[model samples]
Target: MTLYLCLPLLAVLLQPALCLNCSSQFERTPDNSDLIVDCGTSVITLQINLCTAHWAGFNSSDLALNGNHNNSKCKGSIDTSVDPPVIHYQLPVNDSQDNPCRQSLQIVDEAPDPSGPFSAFSSIQSVIITGYIDTPRSDQGVISYSTDLYYHFSCRYPLEYLINNTEIVASSVSVATSENNGTFIDTLMMRVFNGSDYGYGLSVPPTGLELRTRIYVEVKAVNLTGNFNVLLDHCFGTPSPYNMSQSEQHNFFTGCSTDQRTTVTSNGLSKVARFDFEAFRFVQHRDQAKSSIYLHCILRLCEPTKCQELLSACNSRRKRSLTPFGEESNESATVSVGPLYTAREDTPSAAAYSNNMAPESAEDDVTGLVVGVVFGTAAAVALVLGGWFALKKYYRV
Candidate 1:
């Protein structure tokens, strides 16, 4: 075939590999300007600033949102009035039939564990945006050229809004059970703290908590939308995790605290509802036995617009009801955390206990523990007696 004919065929075969030569990553100028991605309520905006010194021929057509070559929802333009140029893009946040360009949303949640940091967060929702750039097509024979590699970049954002509420709850915790029988809520977590931070004081097994110590707790709404904030309606603590071994103490009733320390950080003003109380042992706790403390909360997500008024009027003598998430029905869900043992007087301090204890040994039975202690004592006594006998025999008086 003629050289001209071959060139045409080669270009057709390499059509899939158009090289946009986009930067390897976000490029920052000496003055500090770089790629900026802004997430908004209904639309997302992205701006890419490139210095003419390094990117002389860069244009707005080199990058595609989600790699959609024919996407109608995304639009872009290039600005060259200044020494460097800026490429701008705007796309809808939501995906629909009219505009097929789609962004992804993800929800992350895990069951709370005994670990200090792990037990505190129950759930989180995040939105992720992605895009890809075109690069040079590979060719050989008579033609030779260098090319940049294709790249896909992503950015993540939490689906939460800015709230102005920052009240600290002052209520203390006591033994209690669930007053409402509603089903359990998903993605809500309960976190415990002994002092300023999450003290390693909460034990596995064979360990115990210091009695009468203050405990701070935070409860967060995970799967709910960003428009709603969690509010504590009622809460109680007990020695048992699920069953009622004894009468429980009341922390909050109808959004009002029974004690000053037993505060609900806000009256449905924030997504994370916080409160605190002191740790105590069961009056009838047995000796040398494994034990735990469980906390139960009856709460719901409420819109900020209606939460303050609804919770404030709780002090009035009129009949009161709560409609969680601005719904007509009185919907609420229960969240609980437990198997938390108070540190025994003989146990290590909270920080050491958290770092040293094995989670598996917590389930060991008391009988097994007692047997091990006895065996160790017997071995020590036998060693002492044997040493005395050997010394007396060696003297041979």
Candidate 2:
């Protein structure tokens, strides 16, 4: 009697389950797989290892195109019975949308396939389907992001690696500015310390310092296609649109070239563009001035052959051994070696030299000249008078 009483209650609960089964539960089999790119057919089909072309969703009765999902329940499933289980689809492929940048495959349930046996499938549609194609790697790939290079410098040698012809490197850099009592002053100080003896193929420890008054420009570039060299073509400054005159372009920021690569040091790395102006030299030309700076660079991916050639050159340079100064042995040679000579002072003793006299006065010089002239004039007068007297006596005789 208890079992019979419970059966009524169980029937009530099971009623909803029966209705769910009776309703067609539409399902697309072999879900979530890559589509084989097909452009020939507009019909939707199914295959073991491909996406379905037509609506494979479930419906109790063949339903017309209506957006209502209450009519049927759709479930997604993956069938793995075949060698490469895939639900194939014959949806028309759009060649225009066949790129990594575009959305090639879109499965929509708003419309039905226009053709064939499952034409009544109003709940599913393949809007766009395209075959898989490998995308080309970006030539100028960004491994790390940084704006610190703008303000602070870092080491450039001992690069981590090269990607797309770009040398993945780090640098130690710094920037500082001081005002000379409201006067504009810019200075760049650079230094470098290498952990290894060989730095860019040099035995001497790498270290440098540079002080410039002009604004420094550091240029950096990467080839996007990996086909050309990265060249710093040009750099210019645009005046702060607001304060054009107050912010005159510094002289140092003139035409910069690709060859003007910066030499790195502790304070900062070499900038691609540097101004010719010094802190002290007075700027005469104020006609051409801009406040903001802009640099244009060109990038070309490097050729594999060129990279190999450069590597070979570097290897050869590193392999060349240092020549030894004439070989020396521990045993002394019979030939006599000259004694080291020390230079002696050749200057005379202070006692032997006369002391320098004070400079004579102009008045004293004038007085001496006057006295000599007066004596000379008086003697001449006396001689003239005596000669005249003798001539007169001789004439009388």
The lDDT of each candidate is 0.48, 0.26
**Judged by lDDT against the true structure, how good is candidate 2?**
0.26
- Least lDDT summed over 10 consecutive residues: which range in candidate 2? 149-158
Predicted model with the maximum lDDT: 1
Q: What is the TM-score of each candidate against the true structure?
A: 0.37, 0.19
| Model 2 segments more than 4 A misplaced | 1-250, 253-369
Could you tally the backbone clashes for each prediction?
22, 42
Error of 2 at 107 (Å): 33
Q: Which 10 successive residues of model 1 have the least lDDT summed? A: 161-170
lDDT of 2 by residue, 193-273 (tens): 223221331012122111222222232322111122222212222222112133343221111211233322111111211
